[model samples]
Target: MLRVTLEQWRMFKAVVEYGGFNQAAKKVHKSQSSIHTAVHKIEQGLGVKLFTVQGRKTQLTEAGEMMLRRANFLLEEAAKVEAVGQTLGEGIESQLRIAVDEIFPQHLLYKVLEQTSNQYPLLRIELMESVLTGGSELLQNTDVDIAISPVVLSDGFSEELCHIEFVAVASPDHALHRYERDLTLEDLKSHRQIVVRDSAIARKKDDGWLGAHQRWTVSHMTTSIDMITKGLGFAWLPIPAIQVLLDTGRLKPLPLLQQSQRKAQLHLIFKDGDRLGPAARAFIGELRYQCMQLEEVM
Candidate 1:
């Protein structure tokens, strides 16, 4: 059997990584002779020269370079194992599941996740994108640790995260834009309206104007916005999601006599606010910071 110990592999890596056995021993708090002996054992066991003297400096052979790369990957995995243990010792959870409303800014979520990964590399993340009351329902059932939605739960813990602007919009060429005066609910009744279904299984809600005789209901905000932007129907959509499209003239606001836009208060909720883990708390802070950044860009 070709038996190779971790100590031997580590010595190989240490010599190449720290540029010399003497330096590697100093960094790892071991004597230079011990590191040299370990490396010598590895070379003899494999019957190959791992390092070659090039002038005054020691250089790795091709086989040594390949082994060094593989060693790095193993060391990284070992570091992750250690990180998980350390975090758990500090009362941090192994995984954080967060439920987010479909209307929330997707870019902001990406930014928050990017930052969180840097801060907690070993923590696992599970993100659920829900529509309307979907996120709130998950919170009620204890399916997620954090819930970010417009619906405020009556119990547990909740705090206002941010305000999302829902603007009534349609394709630029839609019939609603042909009107000479401010449109009314009666005017909207003549056309088709795009409606997004509430994601809650039991507590579904009938939100916004449903006066239109012809309407199409979709399960996601993307589908609803796609239908409206394609001139299939008109509906209110969150500006953070469609601001670029709106700016590019793909959609226009309905000339409503009133209520052209509505501000929805989004809140962050935790099942046990007082007992939240370190990772969950850090994620909430990242969420708030990223949302504020998105607001400035929007």
Candidate 2:
């Protein structure tokens, strides 16, 4: 007879993830004895030991490690099945997992989510924010349902959103102001520049600030902007994020002497020839709508 119960599978995963039956029981709101029994049943059904009892802790055996890997997938699949069932009864009950670069403000994206929630009340949304390259990698690996990145998609991927402007900016109190009237390519070369080391953007092999003799690299766009605002460095910021600074006479935009200065291209990437899930397709539709609306306003 089939012996691996859902409770046992859940308890097994909790033990593997939480490190012990006691902790897993506390997390899952079950007694330690119940947790132990569930795991024992799982191990017995599989005919393999799941955990090796250390003095005061439990560690996964090779068999346990393998099971732990599959356990996560199984659990996720089970949740999706339940979600699908719920969807059939009411509406789309699945989730959309998206990876986004830090360049886009969460507050702005929240509006999109709000619209989505109203349209699909049963849909859940999760967002993972990272740099452009990291988000792209997550999309490539199918770890996320969608990725908003700043790299043009090609080869194995296809584009969903496009056309973003990137501009070079500096604080008014910074040294770049010295060349306010005489800002030549040569003058720009002698200064230190703050640059974003976006993993995906870097792969484009761009020489964005070729004029700068000294360059400092940062991973976060906000951090780079904060440093620039403090007169610590100059950086390239998206036109929208730096618009306020420019309007308030806090930051100055540099003329792109060469095409290299115009390096950033914001894009939405996904697997080529792939059909997006209902939630994912809905998210993409919202994104496209936002892009079109923003384009008109901009």
Candidate 3:
């Protein structure tokens, strides 16, 4: 028999999370005395102090910190189980939100969505496009149910969907391409570089070379490609994104001495795959099928 109960743990967690017993009581719809009783029971059962007073504020003791960590984990698992049960009873979700990396091939994304929409005419789909850490940010903030990105999120379930190759290229008339021999980092550094700004609201990241003497930071990869195509600057563009331009001689690959192209492995991620709703699962299936269609061409 255990002296500690899940309810006691929840109350204790609520108290710490909400900042005080009074706030916790209001959030949990319990009396302040009940919150106090729960905390007191936990402390007594463990034979240790879980809190200490620091001036007018309540602070967690060392023991409290340890217990709180475990409490949070338990609460998270409980929430997952409850959510799964609810979704199971509900059949299919009315709406599903997904975030994808802006670097992902647009046509493929649309193809998957088109098929998925046809399958579930009643399901509403909300799609968000982000760059670098942007997709992960939306996921961490719980703003979306699923994220497809190259940046692997810390705790999300992930499956590698495909790899995208970014090729360093410049307009044929650009000064960087005028070089007779293979381009060196030092030689390329003298020319202008078009960079795409990471779309993450928080923790924005800089991708590729950031050492150009003249750098033009743009909001999207399309802008970067536009700049490079017009001979305004040079940039590394996803092959699929600029394949037409490359074939039309609007953009030419930089004759770099080494590593002119970089590969980014994109992944499909979600908070909890096992607990995902039917609509989300259906979307994922179509997404994978579309990815396979592209892989065949590659």
Candidate 4:
């Protein structure tokens, strides 16, 4: 048997959050006396003083601080339980929103989407192709149910999806390839470097090396690849995306002394695993399965 009721804990939290019984009562639309009584009952049940009044200001006691932390977790779990019940009763979600970084392999992404569509034909999916921190920003803002990004959010859960290899490359006719010897950082600094812009509106930043004397920033990776292939600039391109270009001699690897290749790990991020609907879970499962297949073949 529980000594303190969930309602009592909620009222206690309300008083603490709103700063006083009167304020909590106004916020919760309850009588001040009732709010005070609920909090009192909590303290009595726990055998601890939860708050202290000093000059009309209510401050949490040492025990109150500890209790508040536990109370918060308890309430959050309770809310999640109720939410799960509602979701179960409501059946599958009508729409799913996902933010995927452009760096993820297109074939695998398409395959995953195709499999998910086959499972939920009537489900609507809003896929947002993001770059760099763009997917993370969307997940943080709760604009997307899931995100595939190189960046991991501090408040969200993430699992390593796959590693993407980026190789420094340029067109065969580009001036950089004219160097007979292994290139140094100084040798590449004089040339124009093409880069994709970070898609995040707030807290935007650049990733990887940006040491070139002249820089050309584009919004999409395809644009950067196009510019590079046209000898407009040189940039590090993902191996999977430019594998055909590399094989056909359209793009040649830069002969750097070291650090010519870089690897970035992409992660699948979500706020809560338990909160995901069947559709979202199916998408994630398909993605993992496809990645495993790729690994086995490689």
For every model shown, what is its TM-score relative to the native structure? 0.86, 0.62, 0.68, 0.69
lDDT value for model 3:
0.87
What is the lDDT, from 0 to 100, of the residue 107 in candidate 1?
80
Which is the leading candidate under TM-score?
Answer: 1
Clashing pairs in 3: none
* Per-residue lDDT over 184-256 for candidate 3, one digit per residue giving the tens place of the 0 to 100 score: 8888888898998888987989878877899999887878888888899888889999989999998999999
Best by lDDT: 4
User: Which scores greater on lDDT, model 3 or model 4?
Assistant: 4
Q: lDDT for model 1, on a 0 to 1 scale?
A: 0.86
> RMSD of model 1, in Å?
3.0
Give model 3's TM-score versus the native structure: 0.68
Q: All models: lDDT?
A: 0.86, 0.73, 0.87, 0.91
CA lDDT of 283 in candidate 4? 97
Off by more than 4 A, model 1: 22-29, 46-48, 54-57, 107-118, 286-298
True lDDT of residue 88, candidate 2: 63
How do the candidates rank by lDDT, highest first? 4, 3, 1, 2
| Poorest lDDT segment (10 consecutive residues) of candidate 3 | 80-89
Please give, for residues 40-77, the per-residue lDDT of candidate 4 as tens digits. 88888889999999999999999999999999999999
Q: Please give the lDDT score for candidate 2.
A: 0.73
In candidate 2, what are the lDDT values of residues 1-298, reduced to their tens digit? 6568666788898887787888898998999999888888887778998888879889999998898788788888888777668786754436778888777645567877888878776676888876757777777767787788865445555564645567777787778776546466676677778876655533433435555778887777777888888888776677777778889988887654554245455677787535565666677788878877776775
Residues 85-132 of candidate 1 have per-residue lDDT tens digits of 888898888898999998888888888888888888788999998877
